[model samples]
Target: MNKTENSRRRGDELLESLYNATMKLATTTKLTNLTFQQIADEARTSRTVLYRRWSTPFDLLQDIYSYKAKKLFDGAFFDELKDNGSLRKDLLQLLTVYQKVHTEIGAEIINNYYFLRAQDKNDNNELLIHKQAVEKHLNATKKILANAEKRGEKIRKISPITLMLPYDLIRTENLIRPTNISKKRLTMMVDEILMPVFVG
Candidate 1:
């Protein structure tokens, strides 16, 4: 490769390494505990490189926050969902991934996003961004249900609130337990609670 191509590839690799380190650290500590030194150590890099690229931890954090948002519900997550032919399988896929995220870094991610959002109440950009993310997920869910209907699955009419019930229930449980909701429990939720509502 030429110099420019090599330089671009190196830059991408650096960012990926930093991002992986940020996510791993996020699982173990609060956002307030994150530091350039810690991230550098986790990424196995020099602090000087981080300092040269990012003026403050918060700048790096903003990039992480945006990345986490896109990673969670957009991009490859949705691509995998679209390939699942069964609604039940689709629900399982989404929830299984979500549970893993909750178990790993749910609290830190929540705290970081809300803390930054709270810091800018007058701006409202944070709220708008969050709302847009939710809408995108909801639209994906709607398409899943629509596909099920097309396949002649026995599904009842569902309201928006009912469609959100599974996640709301999971979030509530997380607030109480702050751990990964087990696969068995998630399956029970889909089969017993969420599926009943959709099919009956």
Candidate 2:
């Protein structure tokens, strides 16, 4: 390969290919059955390229999920968070978009990485991933709180457990429902559960 082409492949283009390849395979192959050879073949890149960065398919999968989740945070749904008029309204919209992005990232992968595999005592990777996801949502919530503050709404200091209600509620519901949590249920969560905490 020419130096220019090789350079491009070594850059974002290569990472993108690897991420795409991983997700493509993940869609059909259970994580237990996934192989680096399959990912390398799908990406049309060498195992050397994969090995230079990742030691195992598990590591690559973790990075792929982090990349995908980060992109979702940077996407257009965030703009929709602007001035949703009330904390309750803003949260409902925020979580609807949040759940949509999570759904797009695929629940099976999340379930494996975050919940199911926790029993194996894998490592701190899942904890880090969980923290990253929580921070992104809370950062978005910060905006909602700021906007609510501007509109003369009261904001309160919530304990960590109370602060986590939105994420836990949505996450639990998603696990039960699996990519299909209803708008009605979300509304009820925001109104009946979340509104009391944020606006109480």
Candidate 3:
């Protein structure tokens, strides 16, 4: 292979290794116990390599969260949005995926990091990284909503800030316990609770 091709392949390999190591760390270790050294050892690389690519453990963790969130949304949410056609159907699918990720992985990691950073007042960079990662996910959802708007679908006229309420409510366990929310119920909630405020 040419030198340029070899260099690209090496870069891809490094990213794959890093991603695999991060996934292992996310699933296996509590956020409090995850360390750069642990990740490096798990990936079969050295601390220096990780440090060369990421400024701190938080940076590495942020990259991992971003990667996982993107993968989940791309695999299910985006695909459903593209195929579902109707705005209501797309929004319901989006909400289901959003709730699952928030309650399952995203909220746990983010809440842990937020609590940790709050206790460590000196860790401004960690807080900023976490905030940015969250904003990126939120912005992607907004873009999807915007696309719906472009398609002549009526989006609720609620404040953009309130767009996160449904997921936040689910994450906070406001709904009945041990009950799976049906797509029809989600659609009804959006239409009844959010639509009058957002779409009207």
Q: Pick the candidate with the highest lDDT.
A: 2
lDDT of 2 at 131: 55
- Which stretches of model 3 miss by more than 4 angstroms? 1-9, 71-157, 163-181, 196-200
Supply the TM-score for candidate 1: 0.59
Q: Compared with the true structure, what per-residue lDDT tens digits does model 1 show for residues 2-117?
A: 33333244577878878788878877877677898898777777777778888877678766677666555443456555537777877777666666655555566655665666
Span of 10 residues, lowest total lDDT, candidate 1: 1-10
Model 3 gets an lDDT of 0.60
Off by over 4 Å in 1: 1-61, 82-86, 101-106, 118-123, 127-129
Error of 3 at 170 (Å): 6.3
* Cα-based lDDT at residue 81, candidate 1: 58
Q: Itemize residue pairs with steric clashes in candidate 2.
A: none
Q: lDDT of each model, Cα atoms only?
A: 0.69, 0.73, 0.60
Q: Score every model by TM-score.
A: 0.59, 0.70, 0.53
Candidate 1 residue-wise lDDT at 159: 81
Best by TM-score: 2
